[model samples]
Target: MKIKIYFRIIGLSVLFVLQSCEDFVDIDSPNFQMVTEDVYNKEKTTIAAIQGIYNQLYVANFSTYGVSVLGAMSADILLARTDTYLPFDQHELFSINTTDAGFNQNIWSSAYNMIYMVNRALEGLENANISDDLRQNLQGQILFTRAFTYFYLTNLYGDVPLLLTSDYDTNAIAPRNSKEEVWLQIESDLDEAAALLNKQTEYKDGERFYVNLSVVEAFRARVYLYRKDWSNAESFSSNVIARADLYGLEANPEDVFRANSKEAIWQITPDGVRNFAPEEATHFTLHVNGTGTTITGNTALSDDFLNSLVPLDKRRLWIGEVSSENEHSYFSKKYWFDNDGEIQQYSTVLRLAEQYLIRAEARAMQNKLAEAISDLDQIRARAGIDLITDSNPGINKQALLDTIMIARKRELFAEWGHRWFDLKRTGKVNTVFSSNPTWQNSDALYPIPGEERLKNPFLTQNDGYGN
Candidate 1:
């Protein structure tokens, strides 16, 4: 029932972070005194502290950076060229010594740092002189933020220290919790967040960058599906899918990642970013590095993944290829060059298509084949691929599950580590990587960062990862 809270205050300036109808307070602006107690005394300052977390998310190591380059390489979805992060690409990340693990350490450290900020804000809000309405909004937003983050932490690193307070002495030496323990906290935080906000909570200038009731439901649906709470998953996902005015599948599958797209349920904005293309686009793109001839970059779509798609799949339009001296490879055109010379592309974290996929899988698991196919076919139809209703209308439950799995891989590849998490959660990881002699079942969880273990002697490493 108890959770530890890690502590750190990221030096933040909310000046350029949010560009909405109402301006967020800029911490660095001369007008505000940023003392710890005073930061939450005013409504504007409290919201600024919350939005600062959102701004820093752009700098976090986690996220669907150009579809989560780190996790994609760990899965079969992406490949890195020679002389890159080979350990991640080869499933041998565990071989790295626990001491020199910034490669993996950054991910763990970054997330907990963000969690500490959320905890600090939540504490400040408890006695903040702000109005009830504003206080509730900030509280709900950060609690959801914390739960959203913990979902990834527990998924990537099996059991993690559950931190809930901003006290440094306790968190610095805290022990780990079971994965089930982490999920309970994640759900508990989400349930609390859901109670504080509602449908009429307007999006900032009608943008999806900020979380709302629908965003909370979409994520809760994901958590339920992962837990195999089939009926709850079906019901929650159905709620979001039915919000036709706020969400819909883009008829042209390629338009889904564009900023302000109807399909985007929640996104990280590129506002005030200096010359930024989305992280995924920047990493996944391959172009001539020296000569105007050869394509170069550490990351690209893997042939194993690319070849799995049915020929003529419209989603292929998201890919671009370049060949040099008989070496040809593909890159994602999913997020491409911005026209009109403004950075408007947003990093998509959750989308409507994923909601349908979640619903389809959830419904199928419960033997609701007809309803499941109806959901699956929506993705396939928009994909310009063969629809389940058209070709496999009477498919058996097992076959329908198989088709839905393929649909998820094809649709959600390289986005937020979906393919990686899906393979692990569905128990298909070892089979997928059986050819690699270096792989083991233990590779499913990332090693606890050595730096963190050094700081907290109580932190233990994951299986197959030595201290």
Candidate 2:
């Protein structure tokens, strides 16, 4: 991938070009010549346009906090110390309202802004005089970005507006599409991306940041898994797993987040010196001095979650603690760096481990118990937990699925919205949150951001949040 070269140019030029547009989805750059002709005239400039989308992704609050922290807070794994995060943590209690213009709004706006940029790039690519190979690659990249954005949008706010073009007037009046329609579009984009993207080896530098064939396959597996399309989920996941030459499970779980890990299928590089720390580390780390006393810590692992880890599990090493006045406080070590304070991690969007879990769950749903256990064993082995033995005998389907869910909780926690999405998709939100008096069944879906509904009268609020 020529990602390094594109990103280097993007760091310098992305901001200047982005300033030309006023509306959220408009792509009319302030510099008329630069936006209309120059951006599409040259291969480098076109690449930069695509790179600009990546740049937006690097700092987008939605990607950094919305998907990671907010997602975790919505689940049972993490607790919020600040009021800023409390709305998400206590969303089930009606803390999150249509008017709350915090994370919920940021997530919605940031996602649409990126989608707007992507649509502009796609239009530019279509009209550009670029090579067929280069054009196809760029198309794949843009489609993947759009699909990824819609995936989150639909999941976060049900029945989101699906804007396919950069026509601001058309998009402004666009109405929400059904979740099913949105998912179909997501799969279509991923399928096209998989077809057009080159194999991992074709890229100049074996960069995992850019969209490649393996990444497409992996994401397809995830989408299928979410849709409960077991066969497709298993098949797509297996495709990625078979490409061991390109991706594999890292022996150490921490290595999965390191800058040079082979396990990373796709990751967004952090920006600047201070910003070089991955978002998770910046938000999740609890500051403590050499004396082991807590100085400042914003979030921590819930006691219930911490106690759930088995003693010998290697993943337990990814959690650390500091002594407070009377008790020990713990935080996620998944994104932690050294005390010397150097940036050593990237925000991993997709990796090999998730494909395994997806396949395991998909297979279990299909009643392929033995095969499902085999996939789960791979993750268990990597986590240093005891693998489920075939000799255990007479494992029921529900029991095996319960085992897979537990594995997913431990293996994929505090990453993107996997835990939160898992609970929602499995119809377990009500069962899981039954004890919380404030949690209504409707809490499973977040309300559409109030500002969005205001701008487009066609939009409707989710069930619990009145229009």
Best by TM-score: 2
Per-residue lDDT of candidate 1, residues 61-156 (tens digit): 665541287887788877878555677777777424532255576677667767766777788788888888778877888899999989999988
Model 2 scores a C-alpha lDDT of 0.77
- What lDDT does the true structure give each of the candidates? 0.77, 0.77
What are the runs in model 2 whose C-alpha is more than 4 Å off? 1-13, 20-22, 25-34, 92-100, 198-204, 270-275, 289-295, 338-342, 390-393
lDDT of 2 by residue, 217-321 (tens): 889899999998999999989988987777789998778898657888888873343335777887888876666554576678899998899899999878988
Query: For each candidate, what TM-score against the reference?
Result: 0.91, 0.91
Q: What is the lDDT for 147 in model 1?
A: 98
Alpha-carbon runs more than 4 Å astray in model 1:
1-34, 65-67, 94-100
In Å, residue 22's CA in model 2 sits off its true spot by 5.7
Q: Could you tell me how far off, in angstroms, the CA of residue 120 lies in candidate 2 after the best superposition? A: 0.4
